[model samples]
Target: MRSIIRILGVARDLWPTYAAIVVASLAVAGTGLLTPFIVKAATDHVVDLTQGNASGIATVVWLAAALLAADLANTVLTNVSGYLGDTMAARLRATLSSRYYAKLLALPQRYYDHELTGTVINRLSRSITSVTGFVNMFANSFFQMILTVVAVLAITAYYSWPLAVLLAVIYPVFLWLTTITSARWQVLEAEKNQDLDVAGGRFAEVIGQIRVVKSFVQERRELEVFDDRYRRTVRTTRTQSRYWHTMDATRRGALNVIFFGIFAIIFVQTARGVFTIGVMVLLIQLVTMARQPVFMMSMVVDSGQRAIAGSRDWFAVMAELGERDELPAPVPPTGRATSAPVEVAFDHVSFGYGDDDAVLRDVSFTIRPGERVALVGESGGGKSTLVSLLLRLYSPDQGQIRIDGTDVASLPLEELRGGIGVVFQEAALFSGTIRENIAYGAPDATPEAVVEAARSAGAHEFVSRIPAGYDAEIGERGLKLSGGQKQRIAVARAMLKGAPVLVLDEATSALDSRSERLVQAGLDRLMAGRTTLIIAHRLSTISSVDRIITLRDGRVDEIGTPDELAASGGIYAELLALQASATTRDLKRLRQFDIRV
Candidate 1:
């Protein structure tokens, strides 16, 4: 109910429009009610004329004119209300959609970690569709329906309170029956919606990773899983429908019995001359008018239940804690000017992905200003998690990460992230042209700047050979490009960001020797005069780094210059030994590192 109330609060912003809709709806009901009185007068006049005691045909003609006027007013007012309803619905959808989208963007990354992409999208679609429909239907007709029911009851009671009482009883009976069925109906709907969400999520995942599905030859199995979810919904809905319609029939039966009793009295009295035929006719017509609203109440109740469900889902997302950056958005950096290199520090930092098993434990380190450092470790040693903490992708559970002595959490995200550029382990590119992906965050980068960045990353050669060059569209996730090509483009993207600090997460791992050599040369030049953190298992990448930080078992095992770490025989030295080829020069280098023969 509070969710519904909040939706009404949304209407408060456009009160004038909504108020006008209500007024026009009432007017429509008024005109509709007048038709019954007009018919009564015409009937009375016709009776008088047959007895040759009425005024001439002028009376009949005037009655007909009055009836037409009421109908014309009904038509005009109904259309006016309908137009306003449409306008209100459109505006409400826009307001609701904008708020939902803003909430999605502001939500923390952890929220997405457990959710499916399609489930997130499907919730928004279903919620807004049902909510807007409910609002529009309720505004356009429910108010008018209530007015018509009231007018009919008032007019009927004037002639005979008995019929009015029976009519009044009909509504509460119908409402009570709907209430009895509502809880079960809602339960079924929620269960079915869950199944639908899972099915929808799988549908999206399969499409996004179609290559994997096809390569694994599991197309039929995937289809069966999708079908199974929808089938479950079908069975649940079947039970729901049987219960609802059975109750609906029971309500209708009660209504029919009540009306039979009311009609028996009206006709028996009219035949006995207890009332004029015209009054009896009016009573019957009013009863008919009231019946329509009573019938519509059942439909309204069903829609109301569904709307409540959707609103509950919608608000659940809105209530999630979002990233805090109350300050206004910073404009994108427009020029090549960079921040002076700043020292980065991790102070006894520890973190985990939800569970108690910490990925990084008491990890403490410092990168001096403008130093090049490499993190090397065996798999599952927290090398990547450290980088994620540094970028504020995830916060450390125990301690603070700082840039130049200021806590990273206290710095605005834009300022913190804007000063550092990263090329991730995977080249996460969207389906767009080469130019668009290269200049992703900086959409306004000139062609000359984009070309210069591409050339630096050794990507300009292949790009120039393409018929469309920078304009060539890469398929989803850059599928049209080879893995090496994709990696080069990612490097080019980071090159264009040109931040004073750089983080490369195995950026050259996809390239062949020749390509790696070319890209590494470019990276060597980019590292000059900039603070850089490199995460690598390959010995070749760390050879030029000023220092190496090694992680083992979620703790910092070693931190030293390349030669010092090599002679210390730590994790970095172990990795270099494994990547080394079994040649005299390689063995000599390993022996030099003090590794046991």
Candidate 2:
């Protein structure tokens, strides 16, 4: 009930339309009530004519006209109510969908890690549809059913009070049964919903990683997994369907028996002359009228229960805390001036991903403006975590990080992030033209500036050689491009943004020597004059960095120039020696191959 009220509250903006629907509904019901009376009068006139009453013919014509008028009024009002109901449903759907989408964008990244994409999509789609269905059913069916039931009972009482009393007593029992059945049905619906979510999540997981499945020749394995989940969903759906059909059959059976008994009673009373033929006919029609609401009551209750279940799931997501931007509003940008280099300082910062031990423990470091520093460490030694902190992807558990002498937390989120450009090892590109991808970070950048950035990133030569130049379409994630080409495009995008701070995470680690040379040239140009932080695994790439920060076991093991660290015989020295030895072995193999040739 609370969920239903909340959904209605979301549709509060459309209250005027709802009001119009209500007025139309009432008008239709009023016209409908007069229908049986007109039919009753017309029947009595026919009886009078058979009994040789000469004026009965004119009376019958007038009664037929009245009945036709009432029917016409009912039809018109019902159509008007349906139009208003449809309009209200459309408004509610649009409003709720937009709100949910905004909430999705605002939610913190951590929320997405635990939730499946397919499950979220299903919940969002189902919930909105449920809300709309509930509103339409309530406005068009349930409201009319109530009014029709009440009007029918009143007219029945006007003819015979005992019959009306009997119906009133039976109505409550039917309602009680519907309420209990619907409650059980709602529980089953929740179970079915869970099964569907699991099935959808599994299917989506398989489809997203289809390449891995095909390479491993595990198509059969994936098919079996999906089949298992699908079978479970089918079982749950079948059980729910059986329960629904059983309840429907039970309700109809009960109504049929009660209606038959009432009809028999009316027949006996008429034969005893306790009622006229017209009254008997009217009572029989009213009994049929009463059945409409009783039958529709079950359907209304079923739809209500489904809507309530969906609303609960939908509101739960809406209730989640969104990512808060703690800083004040952004200052307007001053014309096209270049961003100055950023100075960064980490002061006693510590953080953990909801663990007892910190990933970065009391780490302290600083990079002067325009200095290019490389962060080198063994895997899980906090290098990536440090960069993530700089990006404010996660907040520090203990101390603060400062940028340009100001605490980063105090800066507007957009302003803080807008000042940094990142190029990951895998160049993440959306499906779009090359020009669009390059200008993603700076959407309003002029085309000349985009071409200039591409040239500086060493991407212009190849981009111009393509059929459409910068306008060529790149498939999903830029899969159509080679490793080196994708990295160059990514570099071009970052360059176009022209942020003061650049963070490169093993940008060329995956490429071949030739590709690496091409991408390294682009990286060199991108890193020039920027306060750059490079997270490098290959020691050879960072030999020219101004300084190296070596981390070990979540603490700074060493921080010095690469040459200084090499002479100190520290962790950086050990890594350098290992790579050197690997290189020597590779050179020897090359010589042997040359001699053989």
Output the number of the lDDT-best candidate: 1
Model 2: pairs clashing at backbone N, Cα or C within 3 Å: none
| lDDT measured at residue 183 in model 2 versus the true structure, 0 to 100 | 71
lDDT of 2 at 334: 18
| Regions more than 4 Å wrong, model 1 | 10-12, 50-66, 325-328, 334-337, 581-597
RMSD of each: 3.9, 4.4
Tens digit of per-residue lDDT, candidate 2, span 238-294: 887788778779977987887778898899999999987888888888888888788
| Local distance difference test, each candidate | 0.85, 0.80
Candidate with the greatest TM-score versus the true structure: 1
> Where does the lowest 10-residue lDDT sum fall in candidate 2?
588-597
